[model samples]
Target chain A: MACSCVAAHLFHGGDFGMSVVIQQIVTGLSIGGVYALLAVGYALIYSVFDFSNFAFGCVMMVSAFVAYYSILAGCSVAMGIALAIAVGILFSVFIELIAYRPLRKKNTSRLFLMITGIGIDMAVTNTAVNLLGANYRPFPNVSVTEPIMMGNIAVGKIDIIALIVSLVALGILWVFLEKTKPGLAIRASAYDTSTAGIMGINVNQVSIIVFVISGVVAAIAGIFFGMKYAIYPSMGTVSTKAFIASVIGGLGNLEGAVIGGIILGLLETFVSGYISSTYRDLFSYGLLILVLLFMPGGLLAKSKSDKL
Target chain B: MKRKLLALLLAAAMVLSLAACGSKEGSDLPGITAGKTIKIGFVGFLSGQDAYLGQGAKMALEDYIEELNAKGGILGKKVELIAYDIGMDPNTETANACNRLIQQDKVVAIIGPESTEQAMVAIPIVTEGKVPMVVTTASNPLVTVAEDGTLNKYMYRMCFTDPYQGTALANFAYNDLGLRNTAFLGDVTNIYCEGIQNCYRDEFTKIGGSIATEEGMMASDVDFRAQLTTIAESGADSILLATGSYKVVSFVAKQMRQLGLDLTLLGVDGWYANELLDLAGPELEGSFMTNMVSDDDPIFADYIEKFTAKHPGTTPNVYAYYALDAMMSIEWAINQAGVANSTEIMNKLETMKDVPVFTDKLTIEPDTHNPHNKTVSIIQITDSQFKTYKLYTPEDK
Candidate 1:
């Protein structure tokens, strides 16, 4: 089998060279970058609330469909994206208020809250299935499908764009958390909501802000993913990967989720590139197990507890 | 009054228990009640992953029933089709629907559950009830055979089975394209995909083409970069995607090209849909897939026109055509046999030949009850439109 590949590449004149390896990594990173964008928000919610906002995935799906229809209704690509983001924010805050806020007020158990989140995820995604049908709704062309070749390595336009957007989003988030007053209030609340409230931050306002930010980021991820792949009701369930990334990043660490997502993506690509695509999932989830056993706090997570 | 109420409750309980045991108390499955109409049952996934399959079949059935009734039905009895949607959900609802169509609908015959998995589960129930069921798109051989490989007397398939199409695809790849090395990527969990994979492996290897790699994919997985990257490295000139889904294939095609693998893609009739072209976009321009007939084939222009008029801007996929043929074949069988009994109609179908179907001439093999000598149109997607490339027929060898 290996000999056949070597012979084919040799005969074809590429020789399975370094260029191909770089190309695979670049492509994998783009995919991983999208996962990080999603998982970071997932981690942030988990960090502040101490419960998985599983409904966040469904919110992203809702945004994806909104963007798809916006494109179909003759909206420009930029407007479609903007519409998706606005709708995403709406759903995010809505779910937060309806599904989480009451539970928070009542001081529900984390398990109960997580279960409610799962219930919301199912209800919304399934409702979409009922209303929209499970057929694949192809997102209209937003970018050229051509690859931009830089010397030896060929890069997809979507790939380069997704990677750049993800980095910028993450950079903006980092700066907001480190440099601004609201960002400081958000961080302070995440540390201790009661203490932050006592120190003059409105905890309810902080929660809304966090949800809106998550919605904005998730909406971007949803739009890009819908373009690259087809959009359907169940596309939101792809958040299973984000959930895994969040856990691998020690449950609530932002920077750790990003690293975990990229690492998982690279590992999957490398495994499929070198060993076998069949084992890609095995190695990826296997790495998850390995990480849990050795470094449960993740590469960047300071402790097993909360950090935003 | 209390004693009377207790006696009434006891009587109702006994009656309900009896009904549960009978399970056939419904009025729908009345057998040949000498009505002024002949009834047949249709079941398909009108919702979920295979929704369009059922939706297309529904469109075909509705149009066909209207056309048949206008022509005074099969042998002068107005044809009444009792249709049901299985919703393509993850449950035994398909089996339940099959049972209802068999025990409740009480039609002379049953038409379809376009999904192979649904058909596999439902066929046994239909067979046990001794109703003749001619499936449309579910082509796995097990559909027409028992596990021990005996021919099922009642189960019939209107479309060519997987083994034939699978062999034809391999032959096309090796002989027509002159490709020596090919790889197989499919869902091992899928009964339909696995059948095609196994058949492709045997036929391609028999034709002297080596399989560079064989990989597995889950239907739920959206990412194929890893599996595709592996296939790319294997240096195969083409990839035979045995999966029976548009979304999975579309993602793989785009990702395959993105990785710069650029291998030719081949698939079965499952790739026949306008949605596939939209989802795959430019990446699938040169890819090939076997179809019963291309939508643009002049032979189907009339059918397309009628369907589009009925559906308003929707091009009928291969499943719709197959369902139309299924209904037509059942009507022909009833006409040839000149009776409404399922046994006689099924016997007539066992030896059906040269029936004018939507695709072309179709003949059912007497021994296996599968379509014989059916034409397989090799279709190419050029500029995102389906164009006929060539035709090939499969042999058992």
Candidate 2:
């Protein structure tokens, strides 16, 4: 009886109108934009190395912490963001040099490389749990609190900023990858590292550059997330969604990663808005399963021979 | 010859360590006080995110034991404490801690475990072990009472139940805040959240208040914009966050502000932690929460003074208050029976009435083994500091 009463009130009194729909769409796009940042970086690394850098999540977490303490230590917000990116780049490169490079030098199997990435992720997350006490540290109000109302629809300034920043960053990355000589070298390495090396492309240089790019995007994603929510050690778990998004896109395709993230975000918001929030994760994972079963190579699947 | 010598040394060392452990485990009969000390075991999370509760409880127990030993130990035997960290895993870790405390430590009684999940895991073990436990702040009714309405004979709790807290908050919301419609934002994965959410929903609806939306999330979820966006559209004047996870609470608060939905936030004892302030100070300003104790409560003045002196630069959270009460209540029961026996202690506790604790007077109801007629405090955040707004006693159901 009580459930029905609540349901009746929700349907009749509550406004499920056009403005609400617009708000949900804006929220979805903002979240999708952040997911796209992480997914693109993840895809970039996978495209070059043929392994998922699961430790990318920990890099994001550490960068957020750096940003938090830096700002607390009297640095301006801009400085804080810059410091976060710098730390992210440094940590990612450090992990590669110490952990991955040693294993790669041994001519280790790809499975071993993936496992090492997972090991690094666990080690870093646990170390963070011990060093930084498990507490949520919220970012100071960096974005304007006032909502921009366009007719009936209300949008926060942070959401708009997130969208614009994601687009510009991804656009710059697209141009760099398509037009630059180094980008060509990196792409050639992704296609065939041995062939790229034989043709005078610096394979080792490509590896470091890819990691550097991954770190930049991870830092940007981490900052946006920390600003949106509070930052804790396990906040890196957001990368799980990014991982799922990247998988839903073809694993090695940059464009597919972006589309997959946007699609995931839109579906999550629409489900939560119309149906129930409980089923939102269920739908996302279910979609992943469906994609895997029907289209194992993902929505933008390359030919089997090309992937091999 | 060298290999033989190394093997022999390893064997001898292992045997000696085994002997040391054997001696440490006092006697075969549990709680008989074989040696000069009466052992008391404490099981709580000393690591991970919820470590604050367990560590605080451990400190309070250690302090109480020190004071008790100085005043001449229970029944003239020096009191000994053996504490274990249950950590985050409830099923296995809590079970191991309770088992080791009862079997190996041979403790006369036990105190511990703050969350309802841990308490539930510990209940069956403690009951089977016949080692009475005074649980601190595990507020689910089932912690002490079963679903079949039978009392868990070996278990007792220091804080008020989730239903009581929910009812109190609902009454406060309807009567004081005068809000008619509200939304529920909670972590379904948490029993504490679910318990309070169910009760608050039933009681709030019973009193003619309508819920606009009820959104569920796991504790692992960080992004709540999707849910918040829905709540904003639902025309709800406020949101009831049923989770005690200050992490989730602070996240929801900050995200709500970012979404431009300045809905009044309602919370439970979970919001009593100081970390919430550090995380979402500005966002939580003017929000209301229900708790059993606050830092400035006069009744805890003596305890607070001693605690602050013991651990400087840290104010006692609600866990510290309840832990002190749990220790004192166990002390009272043991003193009334005049022995360090679990059965006698449980019997004495069942009929206890008007026994004073650090926070307030406690009375154990025989049927449920829960504190009866405990006062729940309504706390309002004023400029990021928690000020006690009102003291409410829920009507007996």
By DockQ, who's the top model here? Answer: 1
Clashing pairs in 1: B29-B104, B29-B106
TM-scores of the candidates are 0.90, 0.91
Model 2 per-residue lDDT tens digits across residues B219-319: 77776777887787778888999887788887777666655566788999987778888887777888999988766778678877878898887656777
- Candidates' lDDT values, in order? 0.80, 0.82
lDDT of 2 at B232: 74
Off by over 4 Å in 2: A1-15, A140-146, A303-308, B1-34, B395-397
Cα deviation at A266, candidate 2, in Å, is 1.4
**Candidate 1 residue runs with Cα over 4 Å from true position:** A1-11, A17-21, A150-152, A274-278, A293-296, A304-306, B1-36, B394-397
DockQ of each: 0.39, 0.34
CA shift of A178, model 1, Å: 1.6
Cα error, residue B368 of model 1, in Å, equals: 0.4
In lDDT terms, which candidate is top?
Answer: 2
Model 1 Cα RMSD, Å?
4.6
Relative to the unseen true structure, what is the C-alpha lDDT of residue A159 in candidate 2, on a scale of 0 to 100? 72
Docking verdict class for candidate 2: acceptable
